[model samples]
Target: MKLTASAKLVYNFTGPTEVIGLIQASHSGDQTILSEELILSPDAALVEDEDVRGDRRFRTCLSTETSIVYTATVDNGMRSLLPRSGRQHLWNELPPEALAYLLPSRFCPSDSFQRFAQREFGSAGDGVSRVMSILEWIAAEVDYVAGVSTPESSAAHTFTVRAGVCRDFTHLGITFCRALSIPARAVSAYSLDVQPPDFHAVMEVYLENAWWLVDPTRLAPIEGIIRIAHGRDAADTAFLTTDKACTVVSQTVQVSRVDTAS
Candidate 1:
C-alpha cells in the first residue's frame, strides 16, 4: 500500500535551542520513499543522519519561534505474516545486536517486570505464543486513556494503572517480551488507522531471525504502519527533542492512503 504522511509543529523558544526531529518516514527494504519535502521556517542550516536501523534524524538550532513541516509519499510493501511457532532462541543463540533490546531501558524496565512476566505468561508456550498472550492480556486489561500517563511514565506505572496511550502499551509489551528473554524494541510510525491521526507507537519483536511489528493497542494494523524511528523506548524515538526549554504552540500529524490505480 501507498501512504502520504505529514506533520506540522510550531514551538516557542525562550532562546536559541538545539533541536532534533525524527518525523520523516524511514527508507527500508520493505518501504520505499517515492517523494518527500521538508520546510523549516526561517530556513536554518540542518544536519541529517541515519542510524543503523534506518531511523532518520535532522538537527538544527532555533531562536524565538519555529515551524516545521514535513511530507512524504511512501510505498509500504510490508505484508502481514503469520506468527512463527518456532522455538525461542537461547541466550547464547541470540545475535549480538539483539542483546541490547533484551535488557531494560528507560521506559521499559524489563528487569523490574521479570517476576510478574514469568508468573503471568510463563506457560504461554513458545516465544510467539507468549507474545500473542501478552497482546491479548493488554487488549483485555488495559484502558487506552490518553492523559493518564505523562512523559515520565514507565512500564511499571502503566502496569500499575492498567491504562495508557500507544506509547505505554508498546513499552509494556516490550517489557514483557524482554522479561521472557525475547528481544523487543519500541517503534514510532505513521499509521493510517490511528484515530485523531498522529505519530503512532508500536513494538517490534525479534522472532524467526527478523523483526515483526506488533500493536498491542490494536489501534492500527501492522501492514498500515510506516516505520519512522525505533529504539529501546520512547526516549530514543521521540519525534522532537529540544535542549532548551520550549513550549509547544501547535502540532498536527496526518496519515492517509493514496490509491495508485487510475
Candidate 2:
C-alpha cells in the first residue's frame, strides 16, 4: 500500500509577530506495514523541514510577518511490519535521569497513571504492548467531538470528558506512555485525504532502542497512511502561527488520499 497527503497552511497576524514559528508535521515514516518513499515540505521562506526516523518530525520555520503560507506532502510505502526483540538498540542512550523530567506537569505524572500501569500492564512489561493497550483503551472509551479542545488540552481532560479530537486523544496516549516510563512524545501533523486538512496527532514510544509510532487518533482504524510533523507536545509543533497583532479572518484545509480507482 502507498499513502500520500498534502496540507496548505495559511496564517494571519495583525502586526508583525516579533517571531513566529510553524511546525509542519506532515511526513510518514517506514513502518512494519508502511514505508515512506518521499516527503516534501514546502521551503517557501516560511517553512523549513528536516527528515527524521519516526512517523512525524518537525520542520520549524520562523517568520516576522503578518501572514504566511506553506504546504507539505508525504509519500509512504505500505509494508506489514511488526514488533521484534532487540529493536531497542538506539534507546540504550535513554538516561534514567531524564525519564522523570521528560514529561511536564500537565502530562499528569501521577500515581493514578503509574498505579494503573501496575494493575494493567505492570511497569516492567514491554513498552510497545503497554502503549498499544493504552491507546486502544482510550480510543474505545473516549467519544469523539469537534471544537471541544486544543492541543494544550490535558490527558486528564480526555479521561474525564470522554470526548475530543486528535489532539486530546494523542495527549492522553502520550501522558499515559510517559507516565509509565515508556518515553512517549506527542506528534502534531496534518491528515491529508481528510476533508479539510485536519490536524492529526499521534504518540511515538521508545522501544527496541528506537521510536515506534502509533496513531491513537486514526480517523479510520485501517491502514494506508501518511504522516507529517512531530514534537514533545503541541506547543512544540503547531501547523499555523499568527502574528502578535493580527486577527484571523478565515482558514480552511482540504486533504485527500488518492483513490487509484478514481
Candidate 3:
C-alpha cells in the first residue's frame, strides 16, 4: 500500500529552547519512502541524526519568544502481513540482544507485573498464544478514554485505572508480554485512517526470531502502520522533546492511503 502521512506541531517558547523531534517515517525493510519533507517556520539550523535504536531525530534550538511550527509529509510504501498464530521463541532461544526487552522500563515495569501476568495468563499454551491472550485481556478490561491518563502513567497505573489512550494500552500490553518473558517493545507509527487522527502507538513481540506487530487499540490495520520509532516505552519514542519550557499551541496529524498494490 502507498500512504501519505503528515504532522503539524505548533509551539510557543518562552526562551531559547533546545528541541529534538522524531516525526518521520522510518526507512526500513518493511517500508520504503517515495517522497518526504519537513518544514520548520522561523527556520533554525537542524542537526539530523539516527540513534542506536533506529529513531531519526532532528535537533535544533529556537530563539527567545519564538513561535515554531514544524510540518512533515511523507509518501511511502508499506508491506506488513497479518501474522498467523505459530510457535514462539523460548527465553533461552532468544538472541542475547533481545534480552533487554525483558528488563523493566519506566512505563512498562515488567518486574512488578510478573506475578499478576503469571496468574492471569500462565495457562496459555505458547509464547504467541500468551501474547494474544494479553492483548485480548487488555481490550476486555480497559476503557479507551482520552485524558484519563497523564504522561507519567505506567502499566501499573493503567492496570489500576482500567482506562487510557493508545500509548497506555501499548504500555500495558508490553508489560504483560514482558512479564511472561516474551520480548516485546513499544512502537510509534502513523496509522492510516485512524479516527481522531493522531500519532499511534503499538507493540512488537519477538517470536520465531522475528518481530510481529500487535495493536491493543485495534484502531487500524497492522498493515497500515508506518513505523517511526521503537523503544522501551513512550519516553524514548516521544515525537517531541524540549529542554526549555514550551506550550503547545496546536497539533494535527493526517494519514491517508494514496494507493495499494493487489
The top-ranked prediction according to TM-score is 1
Candidate 1 C-alpha error for residue 50, in Å: 1.2
Candidate 1: worst-modelled 10 consecutive residues by lDDT: 78-87
Model 3: which residue pairs collide?
Answer: none
> Cα lDDT of all candidates, in order?
0.90, 0.54, 0.83
Off by over 4 Å in 2: 1-4, 19-69, 79-102, 105-112, 123-125, 192-196, 220-225, 242-245, 258-262
Candidate numbers sorted by TM-score from highest down: 1, 3, 2
What tens digits encode model 3's per-residue C-alpha lDDT throughout 50-143? 7665668888998544443333344434455435565667778888878988889999999998999999997887777788789889989999
lDDT of 2 by residue, 43-143 (tens): 22333445453333333333322233334333445523326432222234685533532465554443357776557655434566666677678878887
Model 2, residue 26: what's the lDDT? 44
lDDT, candidate 3, at 77: 44
Candidate 1 vs candidate 3: which has greater TM-score?
1
Q: List the residue pairs that clash in candidate 1.
A: none
Of 1 and 3, the candidate ahead on lDDT is: 1
Q: How do all models score by TM-score?
A: 0.97, 0.70, 0.93
Clashes in each model (backbone N, CA, C under 3 Å)? 0, 26, 0
